[model samples]
Target: MNRTLYSGLWWLALPAVLGRLWWRGRKEPGYREHWGERLALGGPAEGQATIVLHAVSVGETRAAEPVVDALLKAYPDCRILLTHMTPTGRATGRQLFAHHGERVVQAYLPYDTGSMTRRFLRRHRPRAVILMETEVWPNLLHACARMDVPVVLANARLSERSLRRGQKAGAVMQEAARAFTLVAAQTELDAARIRSLGASNVEVTGSVKFDVTPPASALEKGDWLRSHIRAGGPERPVFLCASTREGEEVLILDAWQRLADKPAGSLLLLVPRHPQRFDEVADLVTARGMRLARRSQLDLDHAIDGADVLLGDSMGEMFAYYAACDCAYIGGSLLPLGGQNLIEACALGKPVLVGEHTFNFLDATIEAVGDGAALRVKDADALANEAARLLRDHAARMEMGARALAFARRHRGATLRTVELLQRVIR
Candidate 1:
């Protein structure tokens, strides 16, 4: 009743709705980039898929890429439908799977209302639906169950905060989750939470993000990085500020503040998670009384001497940057937003440093730190100290890095497990 009333009011507020979407499109550069696909509806149709996959944003989408590729190889006739709630996810999907996108259609997901959900269900008519991460839209799930579409939650993770909130929305969340045939969660903790949300068929399948076949562009990234700043050589170590978020900026700047007193020729690459914040972060960096240079404009052939910091003002190149560095400071944890996938840095054999608040990646971080694969800094000073120590001591860095790489390789095969689970539903 409430949903119907809200949706009815939503239609009445169409003008405001359209205006908001318009402003949103303008604000997000990625939305502009993907306007062609959205306008063209360039992906596969509803009947074209035996399975449908919806990922909310870039991280979730990236995690699903391996599963999609595996499914494509296994089931030649089944088309893949990829949907995203965020423009960045759409843009990243378009770029990552450009040639195959004609088969793997991309679009903004329909709003999660009964009518819209039903329209989407009927239109796609997929054999199974995979909702990556923990995106659970109540109306959509209800529609899926009504249509008898076998739904699965792949790489599912439910945060403590979300679980507490779901406790309040307990009835609704549980009802929605019960509609799903199974949920392949990332960890035992995740599976426990999903079961609490009323998914009886829940299973822990590990995280598919860990199992991605490294992109062919990996070597090119290393080459590009080597050309710019020589590492494992006579050059001063290059420290990458990988994926720092808003609140972490001051902490990062403080880290840089200490580094400023060092002799010339060291570098800090500040890669903010969102591309929209590049200019904002860059402005902040400039205000700190340090020289800033954009990564795109760099003469990589020359050495980076006297360059204070490099604002990694681009997207889809995180893995490349990770491969081409001495070590990195993973972001989000520094602020309070749990943290992002440090496994990317680990895969590149880069020792990682994080702030104290890491409940988001609790399992992975703990395992890695326990295995000496990463360093956890309690505060800003520790972050700076660890980074400096890692940079200066080649043997110590490599040992930690080697442990990190081994940890990454050890955790491989989540994609296989996820694919195996999907086969049951698709068949």
Candidate 2:
């Protein structure tokens, strides 16, 4: 199908889309709060000079940080009209850019109906549109093109599976692909895949995630968390399982129980990717007879020395979690979900473990594994074994952590390169 049919379909699905949003809001109230913005009905008054940056959800929003900083610095006079699809992404944007004040305005990107997108464009009057990662909407791109707004895809990546899906989407996807003024991809493979979909101005610009520096506040919080975890006891090795998806938690929890030689007083820091699943994961820990303490409930006065697991139920503390852990297992990999980012763990000089499936970050994973910065386990069982081995052996853990930090340092210029590319389009 072409752009017209795609827009028509989006329009037809409006009711069901609203229904789904309402259903999702039962768990995450942020989804329920932005109904007008979703339809391009209400937002800031039009004609503000702004740069539109679309980051779909949490990961994209986080990945967009370095670029956002660069953009703000490069264009001090212009305001950033940040747009997101999810409430978490919106919240994240708010937290990350709150200090910027009126310079960074945010709103929910409307559904990809031509009329709605057109309205959104008119309301924002963005000088250019920069879509983070792989958000290629036909109606939105078409609207941008008609309105003469240059669009760039920054920190772009397209896995083979995603490429196959795009190819299957036929002309509509190709049309959207061709609409991009530029694509700054994470790797050469990503550039090639994006090119195959008709994006002509593709460039290999590495991942912006590598350029993200751990905030000092986050690191300090991590030290405080680590101190609390070891309060009145010997130092405990903290193993962080971060950004875990739904089905993978059961496998991980089961694997945790099966570890033959888990270090004494070892702490498992379990952080689920979605906030709605925090209570569900907490229940999983309690049902399994593990002593649990939530991050939300912990304080300087509260001691969690006896707890087997620390549930990271709070948002925007991932950097602190990375800094607090001795070793980190990047989640979403254990069950064939394209694995979560291991870059943050590596940046923190923590030994990293990932399950076999990391196709989402394939090139970086391969390079990190080859450099001795990261290790890939075949399944949940192997993940537990390797993590146990690392925690038990201090020398091996330190060596791997050193390698991880070195690898992270070697990839620190993506944000600069990405900004240079964006300068060509962002008027």
Candidate 3:
């Protein structure tokens, strides 16, 4: 489709988009609270030399953290304008960079319609635009090009399925890809795939997630929580099913029940990917006859003492969860939902397990397995079995954890490399 058609279609979908925000706000009020920014109706930063960075949601936003800090240090005079589509992402941005005050600006990126995007660009007058990962939009790119705003797709990756979709779109995707000033890819394979999709200046800058360091405060908090739980009785292993989606929870619960050999007083940390599903997941946990303790309701003292499962229902605590767990099963892979990031777990020196489907993080998963930092299981049952076995074999788990830490440390220069690339455009 051409620009006009694409913009028209986006305009047509505005109601559906707003309706989605309203529906999602039933569970997360922040979705409904940011209507003006979502419509590009919010006033701009009101000055020149602003840099705009777009990260779609929590994962991308987290990955963009190091880069945001780097940009702030590299260009002190320029304000960093961070935009995100989800409430969680916005909240995360606020927590990570709010210390900078007005030097860092946070807002919802307007919907990818022609007029809205154009207005956003004209109003903000950004020196450069950087998009985290493979979030490409025809109208946004076209408007950026028309406004002479250099666009960079940083930490870019293109899955096989995504490449196929781009191929299907033919000219539209090709033209959109061409509009980018640079595509700083995570891997050579990602660079090749994006190049095949018509991105001209593609470079393998590696994955910035490797550069993320778990906060010392989170580590201390997790250690305290773990010690308190152990103080209640003998030590019990904590197995985290991190970032699980809707369909996969049932499978996990089934596996949890089938694992009759699980140690007494062991805790299962079930953290759903979406906030909206917390209540639904809690209900599912109770329906399965398992006692649930929500993190939101729990204090550091005795809250998790006798709970069969701990629902990580709070936000901005993923690293804490990773540090608290003995073993973790990366979620979103149990079904065909690709996979969530295992980098945090690895960085925390936690042994990791994954299910069969991991197309979203294919290269990273395979590399971790090759590095002996992670293992791939066939299904939910295998995931449960492996987690239990790892918990039992303390020596083996320690070895794997050591390898995980080593693997993470070896890939720590991506953020620096990505900043070097962005400097060219920012200059």
RMSD of 1: 3.0
Encode model 1's per-residue lDDT on 1-427: one tens digit a residue: 2345545664577566546666776657555444433322333455565577999998888888898899888888877888887888877887778878466777777766467677767777888888998788777788888888888988889888878877776566767878888889989998898788788998888888778756878659766765666433457577888878887877778766876344245677789988878888888888889888787767542435445777788878888888777889888887678888888888888898888778777888888889888888887767877787777788999999999999898888899888898888886
Best-performing candidate as measured by lDDT: 2
After superposing candidate 2 on the true structure, give the runs of residues whose Cα lies further than 4 Å from its correct spot: none
Q: List residue ranges in candidate 3 displaced over 4 A.
A: none
**Candidate 2 per-residue C-alpha lDDT over 217-283 given as tens digits, one digit per residue, 9 for 90 to 100:** 9999999899899988999998999999999888888899888689999999999999999999999
Per-model TM against the reference? 0.91, 0.98, 0.97
Residue pairs with colliding backbones in model 2 are none
User: How well does candidate 2 score on lDDT at residue 388?
Assistant: 90
Q: What lDDT would each prediction earn against the true structure?
A: 0.78, 0.92, 0.89
